[model samples]
Target: MTETLLILGAGQAGAQAVLSLRQQGFAGRLMLIGGEPFLPYQRPPLSKAFLSGALPRERLLIKPENFYRQADVECILDIPAVSLDTAERRLTLADDRQLPFDQLLLATGGRPRQLQCPGADHPRLHYLRTLGDVERLREHFLPGARLIVIGAGYIGLEVAAVAVKHGLKVQVLEAAPRVLARVTGAEVSDFFARVHAEAGVEIHCDTGVVGIDGGADTARVHTAAGDVMEADVVLAGIGLLPNVELAEAAGVACENGILVDDLARSSVPGILAAGDCSNHPSAIYGRRLRLESVQNAIEQAKTAAATMAGKHRPYTQVPWFWSDQYDLKLQTAGILQGHDRALVRGDPRSRSFAVFYLHENRLLAVDAINRPAEFIAARTLIPAGGRLDPARLTDESVAPQQFA
Candidate 1:
């Protein structure tokens, strides 16, 4: 008798696990399932190059169709899993087909958080989470079009930047006091707000959306201040809600996300979770984290594959993320929260600099804007608890590696 492994949600993590399992010499009956019809694809570019018409649809695929065939992996696409029975180790699909597995991996990821206000269901309102969403939204990215963007997070700002490049009149409405407020420090947020403003992008911080009303041709956005703004299309980039209903329904432990150990094992036996759907303990940060980045999905899936392969590698690598806007590349390493002091290494006015976060002389993280060297150095220094003189850190004369 041969063992069988079933992977749920054919996204970044699922695709990576399939490759890693083969590399680990798993030699089992491998199967991948996804709700989307397309093969597992790269999502980061959907809002950047793909939306800008720079990258084609074929380039978005993680692996070509032949790869799955040659690897002898069965891919079940376009159908969603309906239920999970942990006791019997069976998964029921939407078509009423039930499959049994020896081990299961949940990489169900997440979906865009939708607007709950009235008229949010308007046909012109859009949310960018899937490739189909981008394709539909791209049709309305015309020149001189009035676009209203809700939320000032990464997805919101990235879409706004792309919209501006396409000659669209873009207006970003963020309920928070500043753009990127929830993710970065005050100085970083202010810097981004200034950048967007200088690029002809109208930004409204501290403004909230109340409701939406529209006709067949256009839509009207009602703000909390009783101001009504009309737009050809509206996009909401609020945030994401994890896809944990199947796991929750199966009696799996879940908080902010599915609670998992460093090995990617959930509370239930013979089952594991990864990517945006799972919350695992991070020894480096001394806390649990639910990260929604490409790096996290790839690396953590490798860990989960290793565990399933009877390996002993723990998922303790330092977390890093990056964002591309206009001509700027913002790279971050480690968690910036709980820092006592933040130091700027280069001049922000020059549009190139790095901010270092420290707690009691220990390096916590680094936010590097157009500074690749500083970003690379922080990746190693942060995890090693590297210490540096505050005065020297602020001086650009010293190189980042010198601090290490």
Candidate 2:
């Protein structure tokens, strides 16, 4: 009997799973489903190039449309899977259609965290999560328009940079004491803060937005510090909440995201999850993490597909992420948590440097800004658990190979 595999969510992870399955010689039935109307596309570009109109919508697609037809993969678009019956091996779509499957993969990525404050429902208030979001926000990127951006994370900072390029006055409100506080170290955060400031982005750190008020034409952002900032458009890039309701409803263990093992297998047998929606143990970092990067999505999907194809393979890829703001390219590899020391290689003043985070003598992570060579070296060194000398790392004359 030919077994059928039904994949939920047609984002990067889901699309990669289909390709991986075929590559692994899984000739059984394959069906990829997504809530979005379009074919699986890249979401990272939506905030920058796509928003700035530098890249068209067609370029965001992961594969050509006919690739699905040629691969014999059925694509169900513009519809969402509302319920999952793990016991019965079935799924119910939003349109009340129930489909049976021999195996299931949940890649229902994530949704943008919406502002709960008043006036958040205003038409001018935007959250850039989908292609449609960028399209709507692009309409408001006129010259001299006021853009109040809440949060200073990658998404917020990227959007602010793009808005400034379009001649929009961008003001970033961050609740943390510094920009990129949650991800990067203090040195890297300060560097980015200075970079954005020099780029004409007014950053207000530790400023909590109490509420947003006003109507369609304009909005007033009220801060906890008794300040009201008016804006033509309000953009909130707080974070993302992983889509785990379907997994949770089907009795799958979830904590922040669907709990999966290194193989991307959930607690329930015959079911798996990946991408931003799955929390899995990282053999590399020795901790469980739910990564929201495309690198993690593709790697996890490949692991899941291999496992489904009767080839057991563990996912142990080192986590890496990148961000594009203004002309600066920030590439980060590995997790920086619990790092006690940080060594800076190169000068931040020149806008080309790498910050290497270490615990004792072991390399933990690296944040490379406009330094691709250093980033590549760190990616190799960190995963290999190479020893490093702090003095050598700080000296620019010392090559990365010396430490390895």
Candidate 3:
């Protein structure tokens, strides 16, 4: 009799894990559990294309029903695992049914960071992280709806783009000195600030939002800077905290995320974790990072699946991410943190193209706007294990691929 390999959470990580497991010839019985009712879907488009009414909702699914059936993977959608027994290697569902597993993969991703200010519980205040959330916001996506978005992060900005396009009076409030402070440089942030401002979207940088003032049909957003912005809807895109409750409860060694080895294995034997809920110490960047990119989900999932199938190879893939807003397509590869010096290229005024970020000499990170070739070339600069000359980088005549 084949023992089951139970995979918790059917998001990108779990869905990719199942596919990778099958590809690696894991003949064990598969059980995939998820809190979401629908099939595994890509979340990036939710705030951009789906919100903008450019892409249909159905197209976001990772796989159709037929794929799961063909792979012999049993899916328990819309159900969350209530608890897990470490000694028995078993899982307890909401209904108290016990599921014995030979091995387990935890892809229980992160949840949206909620605000604690006044009127935070109001019905008009929205946080877009799931498909259902987008559906609800779609109703208010029409023209003339005053939309106030807090946080100038990717989600907030993407949502603002869609709202502004629909003729909504959009106002974005960022406590940071500029937009996207954590991800990119001051140049990128200032560029987006100009673009959004030119689009007639009101942006308040270096401003702190105190609370959301709730009313009968709308809310007044109060900022620490003394600006009271009125809106029909308020969207919060603060950040996410990992859903590591189950792992921590089961006595698994946890840190910023579930402490996992390079193979994506948890501290416990026969247990593994991936996706946004995992933090693995990497040899590439020589640091620990919990990546939230789709690429990480797919590649780390492959690591877990391959490891489960008895392939003991370390996961060593370069991290990459992409974001699309209006006409700008920003692609980035490698982690950019703690870089001493940064080089900026391209003209943000025209919004044409540019690749800018830090590197001691190696290309630690590259933010390419409308430049796919540079994005691809920068990927090699990191792992190539050589310091790229800063002078050659800034020279307009030199191509990024010439780093070779």
Candidate 4:
């Protein structure tokens, strides 16, 4: 008999798991379940082109309906898996139906964190995470309207770029000293700080909204620094909290997220975790990380599916991420933590440059700003553990080909 695979979330990770299983020649019965009522879709663009009216909802889908039917993948949409019975290897749905599985993958994903201040729950205040939320938020985002975004993180900043393009008044409140303070270095934070400010964005650093005042027609934001900004719409771009309650209640190890091993296996023998809902020990960075990027979901789900299909291999992939801010195309390769030096090979003011984050004596990561050559070169730079000389780095006359 073929094994039964029950995937708990139909987001990027869950959808990739089904695709990976088929690619790896797994002859299993696959059943994917999600709370959303649509087919699996790519989420990164939701905060970017989707909200900006550059892309339609149909283009966001990762796969077409015909692909699922041809793959024989059973999909249950608009239904959430409620409870898990570890001992019985079954899951109870909201309608009281039991789903029996030989193996299960938890890709429950995550939800956006909301502010709890006064008037936070007002109708004007919104948080964007799903396609439905994006559709709703886009309605209130009229051109030339005032938009107050709380948080200077990735989503918030991306939305600011769109609001600016539409000629909307944009004010972003960040509690940290710099934007993306914990993720990247001081240089990166400073770079974006300047980028947004130059684009007519009112970015308030070292400040946070203490209370929200939703007036009869406008929403007013009262900051901790005693600054008040009125807005026609409010967007909460705070971080995300993983949907680990189901895993934690089922006795799965839960840390910052569902604690998974190298193979994406949780504490439960038959249970596995992947994507935003997982905090896996990254062999590349030597620490546990929960990445909400499309790269992590696809790569980690592929590793998880391979392991579930009887293949034994450690999940290790070069960690990379990117963000699109206006005409700036930022491509990053490798994990850049614990870097002692940052070498700028190109010019930031020219808007075409690359910043190399070197750790100790080895190359850690490269943040290329519209420089595809440096970005591609650094992919091999970190994997080979190559040494980069700071003197040759800044000299644009010396090509990056020498490092190869």
Worst ten in a row by lDDT for model 4: 385-394
Per-model TM against the reference: 0.98, 0.99, 0.97, 0.96
1-404 per-residue lDDT for model 2 (tens digits):
98999989999999999999998999999999999998999999988898888998899999999999999999999999999998899999999989899989999999999888777787778998888888888888999999999999999999999988889999999999999999999999999899889989999999999888887789899998999999999899999999999999889999999999988999999899999999999877788999999999999999999888888889998899999988899999999999999988888999999999999778889999998888888888887886777898888888876766
Ranking by lDDT: 1, 2, 4, 3
Candidate 1 per-residue lDDT over residues 33-139, each given as its tens digit: 99999999999998899999999999999999999998888999999999999999999999999989999999999999999999989889999999999999999
Better of 2 and 4 by lDDT: 2
Give the backbone clash total of model 4. Answer: 0
The model with the greater lDDT, 1 or 3, is: 1
Q: Against the unseen true structure, what C-alpha lDDT does each candidate score?
A: 0.92, 0.92, 0.86, 0.87
Error of 4 at 257 (Å): 1.3
Residue 47 of candidate 4: its Cα lDDT?
Answer: 82
lDDT of 3 by residue, 355-397 (tens): 5455557667888888787788887777775777777777768
Error of 1 at 275 (Å): 0.4
Candidate 4, residues 1-404, lDDT tens digits: the string is: 87899989999999999999888898779999999998899888888988888998889999999988989999999989889999999998888889999999999999999798888877888898999998888888888899988898888999999989988999988899888776667767788889999999988889988998866568988988887889999999899999999888888889999999999899999789999999999766778988888888888899889888888767777777888889988888877778989887766788888888888768888888898888888777787776667777678987887764
Considering only N, C-alpha and C atoms within 3 Å, which residue pairs clash in candidate 1? none
